[model samples]
Target: MTVLVTGANGLIGRALCERLQQKKQAFRAAVRPGVPVQPGCDVAEVGELNQATNWCRALTGVDIVIHLAARVHVMHDKSADPLAVFRTVNVDGTLNLARQAVDAGVKRFVFVSSIKVNGEATKMGRPFTEADAPNPQDAYGQSKCEAEQGLRQIAMDTGIEVVIIRPPLVYGPGVKANFAALMRAVQRGWPLPLGAVHNQRSLVALDNLVDFIITCMTHLQAANQTFLVSDGQDLSTTELVRGMAQAAGVSARLLPVPVWVLQAGAKLLGKGDAVQRLCGNLQVDISKARDLLGWVPPVSVEEGLGRCVRG
Candidate 1:
């Protein structure tokens, strides 16, 4: 079956393309104009993802569409209307592609959503599950929730299959943003103030996420389902930092500052959100993906962290 992958140059997309090529899968890469891709790739230049964006050319003869292109979460958004900006790309653009794909006789659409769709953080020992009602806390999360709702409606209206996968923070060799910065800081032996913070966070490796996405492409049981995925392991912030440091061949020098003090400092510095992310209890339960699909993370957290550090 022919497949189309949008945002083909992104971290997860790059790894996915490499895996698909290794497996000799027939696929096309959808990217913006002027982006460098491998030679001889079936590239579709779908510029500026939004409501008005046209994807007819890209969806031609494509049996499966993996919708990964969206207005990603920004740490410090400069947009005056963040919700509108996210809706234009994440919600409207997603539905546009879904409708066009349905019209093109595509069988399945796999959407990569964020765990933020469930909520920012889970209560201690109360991991998020697929059955949980959506409680999006940010514009990005709200847009994804809306997209999922729209896609479900599209599926009902058009009989095209829809699979939604919500993954927590994904990290790997080419990871960027906060996870990458954490790796760099660990490699540099920077003293972190996470010794006293003992919050559990779940994360998925790039390989694991890619494997699951590939499985959902043609798995009949995956149709009309929402799945939460992770590495099947949880880690405290201090343990994660220590593991990263170990992988980087450095010592984990941690300061034992209380979580309350850190929260106060973050509030004083207007970085409360940052601190919440760093010391938050955000765990996802992947029992549905495991029990229903018999899927397991191919890579362990230790191995994933090693590759991230080595990179």
Candidate 2:
């Protein structure tokens, strides 16, 4: 099947392209201007994603589309209206692509959504599932949620199939942001005040996420379905730091700071969001993907972490 992968230079997109090449699947990579595409793969240069953008050239002879291009949330965004910026790309741009895909005779569209669609955090021991109503907290999450709704409506209006996969924090080789920072700190033998933070969060390795995305490409049961994906392993803040330390060949020096104390200090320092992320309970129940699509994460968390550190 001929497939088109947007955002081909991104973390998950690049990994997915490599895997698809390994499997000898025919596909085309769509990358933004100045972003390098995977060598030996068919490529098209698609510029900024917005409502006015035309995808006719990129959609040529493609049967499936994996839309990953979006205006991701900035931690300290200076934009006056973050939601409007997000909606322009994540919602309107996505819908525009979906309509063009339908016109182009595309059979399926796989969307890589965020776990924030379910909510920012979950109660201890109560993981978020696909059945739960969406409760997006931030503009980014709200945009994704709106995109999902728009895609579903388009799917209903047109006969094209739409599959949504919401993954929590994705980490692996080439991962940046918090995960990379944590790994660097661990490798440097820095002491972290997370021993008393017992909150659990789920993460999906790049390999696992790519595997699931490919599975959804042709799985008959995945049509018009929304699936929550993870590595099937949950880790607390302390455990995660220790695991990273193990991979980095260092001892995890953790300070036993009380969670309440940490929260209060973070609030005073205007770092409450950072504190919540570090000590947040964000778990996902991925039974639907397992039972329905017959998919499981092939890589263990330990193995994935090792690759992340080594890379």
> Top model by lDDT, which number?
2
Candidate 1 per-residue lDDT, tens place, 1-311, comes to 89999989998888888888889999999999999777657899997988788888898989999989888999899999999999999999999999989989999999999999999999989999999999999999999999999999999999999999999999998898989888888888888888888999999989899999999998889999999999999999999999998888889989999999999999999999999999999999999999889898999998989988777
- Return the TM-score for each candidate structure: 0.98, 0.99
Which regions of candidate 1 fall more than 4 Å away from where they truly are?
none
RMSD for each of the candidates:
0.9, 0.8
Top TM-score prediction, candidate number: 2
Q: How far is candidate 1 from the true structure (C-alpha RMSD, Å)?
A: 0.9
Per-residue lDDT, model 2, residue 109, is 99
**For residues 171-241, what per-residue lDDT tens digits would candidate 2 score against the true structure?**
98999998899889989988888888889999998889999999999999999999999999999989999
Instruction: Estimate the overall C-alpha local distance difference test score of candidate 2.
Output: 0.93
Score residue 85 of candidate 1 by CA lDDT.
Answer: 94
